[model samples]
Target: MNESIAIAWPTDDELRAVGETKVLFGHQSVGADILDGVARVYAGASVAAPVIADVSSGEDAPDGTLMHACLGVNGEPLSKFAAFAEMLDTPVAEGVDVALMKLCYVDITASTDVQAVFDAYTSMMADLEAAHPDVRFLYTTVPLTADRGWKSKVRALLGGDDRMGPADNVARERYNTMVREKYAASGRLVDIAAVESAGTDERSQDGHTYHVLNQSLTLDRGHLNEAGSEAVAAELLKTVATYSPVA
Candidate 1:
């Protein structure tokens, strides 16, 4: 499978910094893939990887460990936002250096109101920023589902729903555009959609081409495979390694 840009391994100092950075990640299944990829990344570097712990709450998290947890129900974007906020109220947010919450592909559908969702997201993030001034909040684009294959297309033609197709990805792109516009310039964004779709697959619909999850990277319709996990985890680590908290 074609990869994106070459993985830039952090220097020993930066690696140590990554290990020392206290990060809280709220996500669903795909988040697990990224975390697995993180382990692969550190293993490839031949260094002792950071402590990764799955905790029920922030109070259980150890200092300097990358504590991750599943946030809210899938397909309910607002719930995820609220869950992240609730997570911040715990001790994890007290001295956290970096944190992010990611929405799964099922969170947004073709009929979703992108504007409304973006508005809710912005309000929640702004509040979190004000409440946790010491922590750096990272924004993530919503993940994209894979495009329909020829067989799936045939099924769709025969009146079967393709589950998630290009139309749903279009909605995700709309939200991703908002995220990039708000944070890309400030360098506080992790463009997961971009990484997943990079140099991989594009589906043209209504005379417009939209990036979709690289089929090669996914075993299912949405979740990442090993290669996909490593690809995204590399970017995630690079972002955390290079991040500088604002004074």
Candidate 2:
């Protein structure tokens, strides 16, 4: 049987270095906020004892064995983003053997442009493949949610209001649609939107949204509670089992 390795990289080159079966959890909030959700996503699935690993700052690296779900304990989003951006600007390196790219994030609604996001993602994958012919790429679509306040929080953090507008919601939906279409175009990619959407509905029915922090759902909601995270993790595990050969 072929061994499956998941390389959680912040950039395309670093991703390429690890070679295939790469799960790219793109730019979403990290820290304890999503730890449970991440775990659930990985644990709920049917993997053939697949290894879970992460590439974060020195402080955040997982202490367990390589095959035991490697978690980047101290990786900062800003740093990862900067590194990814830099690699996009430079040339890809050689001898990188990555297969799939899996991305896990909380907010992918109608407010973000789905096409543009996937285009950017696919373009990077294309570049890496151009440099190394043996590599294959797979990316997960941004999950769908009804949290309209997510945009506001992002905007406020950037010096704007704490309320999201209709346009923001529309953009997020568009982004989600784009992901669905793009992943459909490539047989290797995984469409996580279905599971995420279902999970979001479950959260709403429970009289809570996913972005509950400190026992209170924030106004600019874009986080997940323990229950919600568990749901996501279960869905993710299913996705992995379906796509990964090791499973």
Candidate 3:
């Protein structure tokens, strides 16, 4: 990563004028690689964009060009939409030209009300648009857990019956479906459910489990390793490229 990446906050006027082509990223534990890949590609293209990592491990440095908020492990954007409005209100520097905004990992299956989650997300985006009109919102889907055993363990830890139970699968499907439908309803929302679903299926077919992190990918069962992240990044890049102004 280059140390000279640019950073500026969009003005109220500028935010309102932002087009549909900017790149913003909202990510989770394993999805950082996807954001990194997007940054690499955009840098290669000489596109002046910013990648904001909402969750931080504190290992990242502020290059002054790109803004890195090291909000720590517990600082992830809340699962509820209303909380997101408060999250976005946290101040970044002025003149930050954000062309795209991504909200990753709003796992509807994990929430009590899938529709309410979707509605809250929609409302949050609407609030962002009102605050920063220049930035577009891209919502990514929750990836499938490749490790059934690990998932079962997690479920057990949470007092769930079984990770592969019919109810659990149904919830997952319903959440993904709602995400697809919501994205389809608005131009501002970009759906990456197909990509995630396909990637998980491919990995399963190949009998590969675990997520990629750093240079060494792991199969710990919760998040993706670096390899898995890169795969996801590639998929998201392909999606973003479709709307990329430079492309």
RMSD vs true structure, all candidates: 2.4, 10.8, 9.8
Give residue 190's error in model 3 in angstroms.
Answer: 4.3
Best by TM-score: 1
Across 71-186, the per-residue lDDT of candidate 2 in tens digits comes to 22122222333344343233231222223333334333334344555566667666755755653344555433334356555785786643233334344445556665656666
What's the lDDT of the predicted structure labeled candidate 2?
0.38
| CA-lDDT, candidates in order | 0.81, 0.38, 0.43
The sequence of per-residue lDDT tens digits that candidate 1 reaches over residues 161-206 is 7548778888888889888999898787888998888767567777
Q: Which stretches of candidate 1 lie over 4 Å from their true place?
A: 1-5, 57-59, 158-162, 244-247
Pick by TM-score: 2 or 3, better one? 3
For TM-score, candidate 1 versus 2, the one ahead is: 1
Better of 1 and 3 by TM-score: 1
Worst 10 residues of 1 by lDDT: 1-10
TM-score of every model? Answer: 0.91, 0.51, 0.57
Clashes of each: 0, 44, 22
In candidate 2, what residue range of length 10 has the lowest lDDT sum?
Answer: 65-74
Error of 3 at 195 (Å): 1.9
